[model samples]
Target: MFNDGSHGFSAQVSTSGFNRRRFLGGGAAAAAAAVVGPALLAACGSNAAPGSAPAAAPADDGAPATGILRVSNWPLYIADGFVAEFQKASGLTVDYREDYNDDEEWFSKTREPLSRHQSIGCDLVIPSETIAARLHRLGWLNDIRESRWPNKKNLQPGLLNANIDPGRKFTAPYMSGMVGIAYNRAATGRDITKIDDLWDPAFKGKVSMLSDVQDSLGMVMLSQGNSPETPTSETVQKAADVVREQQEAGQIRRFTGNDYASDLAAGNIAVAQAYSGDIVQLQKDNPDLEFIIPESGGTLTMQSMVIPYTAENQKAAEAWIDYVYDRPNYAKLVVFTRYIPVLTDMTDDLNKLDPSAAANPLINPPQSTLDRVKQWPALSDEQTKEFASTYAAITGG
Candidate 1:
């Protein structure tokens, strides 16, 4: 699965028969749009615009359960066989489609219909954190907390009370990834373990940072002993100042999306702010490449499943969420996703399924690393602009 445009990394395995670069293309394009997409939507006075009055929550009409459920997710996001098993166990047919390729594109296509309180033809959709927050603010999603999903307790304790969904009323995390330093050990000639290491004079002009404001700035904030989970405009500006200083001093070679992976692999750059899963994939070709959650900390990004307010099969959608939250079932998913699993107590189950995956730190990070990872808070539109404008001026985006 390609995450929110800002973090474009392929989660698909090679055997899945999908072209990684092809998926990267859509993701890259979306990343470019993400820089300005939200502002543009607000300017156009779109009903789904961020900060607009949230649409009224849909009332439960005591409607009968729809026998069929529709889910739209990023391509190659889910493991096979589980869907078949889910159908057999729940007695509900699933119309699952992997058409959610880009966040900006999906929003553009569904906004008009969703604004009119009409279904986007999906009972469930998987969107990255930023997009999920936008939908929640627009009141376009149903509150799953009202459903009978007992497995909601399986959610990682750290993930509870997300800034976007205070009680996870609207969304459930599908999978997660960390944004941190990825380095070519041969180029660095040593291990890169902390966020400030990117500023070392030895690696000047051989380092890259993500172009996404939240990601790049989040990591920088951590290095300053600040937490991104509760950022203020002042802290964001402080972080952006660091980035500008690094860029002007020739410490940062460039700002990039997932393309940083290629540069790191070919020895064009020694270190980069990179996605965890991308490094997992790159390690296949270059064992020297290593991804680390900076000792200071790193940002966590989640692709979450949500039911649109107008979905027709609410009951079936809740069933699917429950089914996947089951530890044994989620372990099967981690083998395919190769990203961090969202459920707690998953290590033993995952080890039983794919011992290699369970052993990979990128897939199942140690407790110390998890302790340092934090999610960027849900920024209001004004707060977003304050952060984006300053960061954009420095990056020339």
Candidate 2:
């Protein structure tokens, strides 16, 4: 789930691997996923009214017995004892697998089964918003029945009823972050503010963009006064052209995954397209590294949870969603992962766990920063292929 188009777990985690101590100590970016376009997930939780108290699960009303609850998510993305807590509370065998590493890869494994309405082995799976959107469109996911998710009331307003899964009937956010710019202050010798700063001659060949289209081209789109939120092939092509010009002119050093972090920290690159969570973690090692949501705007993204159509443990799956959404439970995640929690009021609680993590602007950006962020729009399969090809070509992948 944390795997963006350009980076994988190896790139996102520390060199020491998924060591809990090092992870909590601030490892790689560890963000859940990338951006979605305008209203991409706008109505995802459409069934639930924002701020409404959660309702009891069907188990309370004598729902059928459930078997083991199988959940697949990104490695090390959640808190240490998250699975244990859920198991203890629900008294259900929880089979949690952190094998979901890439959107495209996971989709390939489950697509055929899901398309045929067959079980995909896991009861619940977390995928990036784009994958979730595609699954919902194919009728492969289950709706998150609100009556069993009383904690739904706490989801930040912006994430509720997202357009991708309106009424959140088919999906719910697992974790979210922003796409922006990260720069080496020492390398640039100046503060960077807007997207245009990336194109400055002083930083030529010292700047990098993401290899993913939703990130690199999306930001480029914003800088060019185009909206990725409602992208057509034409709009996306235009954005791709902008990046091509830079690549051809040798303005950009290279398109990268999270490996760009090492270069930026080492002053190998002065400016790079980056993610909010990654910058926050990177700053623990180098205070000189700064992340900015360009004044023109940035992109907001999330990795989401969805149940397979053939899932046999719907109650347990929904129960897990409710459990995580509970303020205190969610706060544990905020402290451990250092990613922005969708439940907005947990800052006070998070402060107790890690003061620095609680106050970091990159982890908890202000409303002003959020206001300038956009999501990637939904793309048809043909459009997605076209966009992917364009991005690959420009990056020389």
Candidate 3:
């Protein structure tokens, strides 16, 4: 799955030839089945409420630097040559492992050790925002702000103080993807601009939505002028009701994972809820395919880089984060991952690297699109179970 080159190394990491953004978006159904019930609740057993002040981070030991940093991140998320470049620049050896395939699996593996205030053998890990929030609440993550990370100022203005990591005390965004609409223009014979277009009678039985509860239902809620960032039981139920109506009337063809890309490319379906990164790759093969963040709105999900509380190489980990935040280095990462860069200033540097990627709206989204996409709220375990159960009923899981 990996190709080694003279200058650097690249990996065809995923079996489906996509990255973790697509993997999580497509496998969301199975993830929900595996993580949304008792396992999730057990992991979120902290008494602190969401948005409350997180418990004080563990005190930093004055131990000498280990000079070795270990990171566990999702597969194929970084640029080729980055490891070697960082090592050369900082004189640190990085033991980078792409083993963070699933959030729940990682959480399950580390819970026992972390709950005992022990190391899980890695200095840093990257997990989706929700999981990072859970780790913060559990006090399992170190406060990155305490590290010597000057480039933290380069973060996009909107990401500065997210609800999950207010002031980014615990985590920083690594990469992100938007959940939006993708359509085959040859099949639709027109443009698809809004979420409501998917429900139009003209495209009945030729429309497919993602099996991911937050993504599919969030779009429906956006169509009705509701924001998923502040979802309530009433709004969630309303969205679920619309989904049920569409399914029963045959207005919706099916609920899908990553397989929707194949169907859409082959003209088996006209429209599908898709991740932005997936569309970037799909459009290379099918010129007729187009992706858009709906005029009404869409959802944006992010994976974050965090330091474990028990890390032995906190200084080295901080240096690594700072190294990637440099504009030129971050541009290379954006090009390699084909995901949204978390920096406010990237287009110029990205254009210098790859002009084509700099122009792709999916990769370098304009301000208008950025204003319209919202991140889903950090739902409590009970809230998650309720929403997932309702969505399962509609999707007939």
Candidate 4:
């Protein structure tokens, strides 16, 4: 259930039993090399196995929606009581499963079934934006009719029309976290304020960057005054050069995933490219470890909810989405998950529930910080390959 190198959607992803630091020790390079491949991506846009007819979307069999609404999400993501409360409100059963860990792993397991137009045996699933974009392109998800969900009005205006799922017709905002520098105060001997701090000679050979190409490279690009919103060969190369120079100079100890949290917490590394949610949790044990969104900018990584093309219970899926967006329920989720809340209106209530969370810039960054937060653009096959290959080379994959 550890999502260390999996890609940051939130801080809650890096934790004890599923520490990213532990996963990195096994084989950081090997893991990065195989995170995604051409063979798996080939399954993306096909609706059925080759030579077979594309499977039809599941029909809405209007029998009073009674069966369990199956949901696949990351491990330990949801709040303790939300499921039971949701069940009570809707009079439907929930078969929520934490079967999704690594994005590639989930895609591999379900691709053939989805490609063959067969059910992956779930009504709703959470996939990071990058993977979700693949599912969207493959025409494998239900068009989330926003008009039906009254609570959709409560969503932050910016998220309503994502770059990948314009108008959010196929995806709904679930959870999000910022990617930035997390450093142990005692180790760094000073507060780290920007992405450039990772290169400080004093902390050389005691720093780590995420192995995830997008998080590491994208953040670097922002530091150099480039925007990932309209990425190109030149901008990406600029970012790659920065990473390579540090690696070659021995300033970077290793390319990490969520495992950076473990190293930073143990005082093994001074500064690490870290996720906001993970550092929030880590601080409970070691207050000296601070997560910062650089003064210049940072990336806002997100995981969104979507209904697979093969799912039959579309109504139930929509109901669940609407149910969670309701302010009261969402407040509970924000307090429990410790990720950035998409409901802009719930800030006051959340502050009342957990003042510390509201105060933490990582969880609830100020207006200026939010303005600088940027989401990764949806990449085509060529762009994806280029960035991945470039990053893999630096990691020695």
Q: Per-model C-alpha lDDT, please?
A: 0.78, 0.71, 0.77, 0.75
By lDDT, is 3 or 4 better? 3
- Which tens-of-lDDT digit does each residue in 149-265 have in candidate 1? 789999988887888888787889988888889999999999988888899999999999887777788888989988898999888889888888899999999988667766898
The number of residue pairs in model 4 that clash at the backbone is 5
Error of 2 at 346 (Å): 2.2
**Mind giving the per-residue lDDT tens digits that candidate 3 earns over 119-189?**
79899898887778777766667777455678998998888878766788789888888889999999999
- What's the C-alpha lDDT at position 283 in model 1? 86
lDDT tens digits by residue: candidate 4, 1-397: 2344444433344542243223211233433433354355454655332223222334545444566799998876788789999999999999999777666667778877786668899999987777777777666777766555778888888887878878777888887788788899999899999888988999989999888777777778888889887788889889999999999999999987676766788788999987777777677668898887788788878878899988877888888999988987888887777788887767687777778777777777776777788887777767776777787788874
lDDT of 1 at 292: 87
Write the candidate numbers in order of decreasing TM-score. 3, 1, 4, 2
- Model 3 root mean square deviation, Cα atoms: 3.8
TM-score of each: 0.88, 0.83, 0.89, 0.86
Provide the lDDT at 87 for model 1. 91
State residue 307's C-alpha deviation in candidate 1, in Å.
0.6
